[model samples]
Target: MPRLLIAEDDADLGPAMKRALELDGYVVDLFARGDDVLVAVGVGSYDVILLDIGLPHMTGLEVLRALRARRDETPVIVITAFDRTPHRVAGLDAGADDYVVKPVDLEELAARIRSQLRRRERRHDDSLSVGRVTLDFAGHVASMDGEEVLLTAKEFRVLALLMRRSRRFVSKTDLEGELYDQDQWVESNTIEVAISSLRRKFGRDFIRTARGLGYMVGGLEA
Candidate 1:
C-alpha cells in the first residue's frame, strides 16, 4: 500500500479525502494545519502528498517551500480552491509534482497520484536483470527470453523487491514490510504464496530459495 500525507484544513473535506484515498488502497495521514505538514513530511516516508493552499497558520506554499528546501523530493499535488494563475504558478515553481484545484474530483486525484507514483517507480526500475529474465519495476512488467510474463499485483511487488536486491537474500520480514501496510493483516504464507505464483510464471530456477537466509533472484552464481 502507498502512503500519503494530506494537508487540508477543511474539517469535512479532509476526512472525506482521507476516506476516499484509503478506499483506493493508500495509507493516509491527514493534517488540518500547514505547520504540522512540514513535521509529518520530514518524518514519514510518503509516496505522495496532497496539500491545500488556504491552510491555517503557515500556507501550503510555505510548507512546500520548506520541503523542497530540505531537498525532499516526495511527489506533491497542491490541492486548493484557488485556481488563479498566480497561485498555480507559485505552487509549480515551488516544486509540486502536480496540482489540482478544489472542488476536487476524487477519481482524477486518484489517477494523478497513481501517475506520480508510477514515475517514481520508473526512476528506480534501472533494468534489473538476472539470466534470461528481466523485471520492469515501474511498468509492473516482467519479461523472460524476450517474452512478456503476466504477474499479479502481489506477485509483482514480491518479484520487484527481490530483483532489486538480486542475488541477495530478502528475508520474509523485509519482504512483508514492502508488500503490505501496517493495517493490512498479512497471512503467514502470504509471501510464500506470491513466490509460488512467481515461480509458476518464471520457472523454479528463476527465483532461488535458500534454506534459511530467504528468497533471492536467480542465484549468486548466475
Candidate 2:
C-alpha cells in the first residue's frame, strides 16, 4: 500500500480525509501542525503529501519550501480554501506538485494523487534487474532467470526497496519504515524474518549484508 501524509489544521476535516483516503487503499497519516509534518517526513517516507495552506505552527507553504530546500522531491499537493490565482501561483512557486481548492472532492483528490504517483513512476524504469533476479514494479512481479517467483506482499516490498537502491546498503530501520505504517506495531525481528524468507527463494547470497551497514542487492561483491 502507498503511504500518504496530510497536513490540515481543520480538526474535523483532517481525520475525515484520512479515513476516506485509507478506504482508497492508502496508509494515511494526519497532522494539524506544519512542524509535525516536517518531523514525520524526516523519519518516514510518504508517496505523496496533502498540505493545507492554513496550518498551525508553520504554514503549509513554509513546510513545502523547507522540503524543497533539502532536495526532498516527494510529491506534494496543496489543499487549501484559497482559490485565488495568487494563492495557486504561490504554491507552485514554492514547489508544490499540484494544488486543489477546498471543499475538496475526495474523488478528485484521489485522482490527483494517482496522477502524481504515475508521474513519479515514469521517472524510473518499470523493472529492475540485479544478478539473476528481476523485479517488475508495474506488474508487481518478481522473476529469477526468466521464471516467475512468487512473493508475499512483505517480501516484495523488502525486495523492491533493496533493488531500487541496488548500489547502497539499506538499514533495517528504513526497511521497517517502508514495510509498515506509522500506526502499525512492528516486531523487532520482522525485517530479519523477511530477509531470511527472501534468501530462501533467491539464493542465500542474493542479498548481501555488512556489519552496521544493513543490506544490499547488487553493486559490490559481498
* Residue pairs with backbone atoms closer than 3 Å in model 2 (clashes): none
The list of candidate 1 runs beyond 4 A from truth reads 127-222
Q: What are the lDDT scores of the predictions, listed in order?
A: 0.82, 0.87
Model 1 lDDT tens row, 1-222 = 788999998999999999999998899999999889876765345778999988899999998988776656678999989888998899999999899998999999999999999987776655556667777766768898889998877787788788666546789998998877642778889999999888888888878787878888745234
- The collision pairs in model 1 are none
Best by the lDDT measure: 2
Question: Would you estimate the TM-scores of all the predictions?
Answer: 0.59, 0.62
| The 10-residue segment with the lowest total lDDT in model 1 | 213-222
lDDT of 2 at 142: 96
- Model 2: per-residue lDDT, tens digit, 46-66? 779999999989999999998
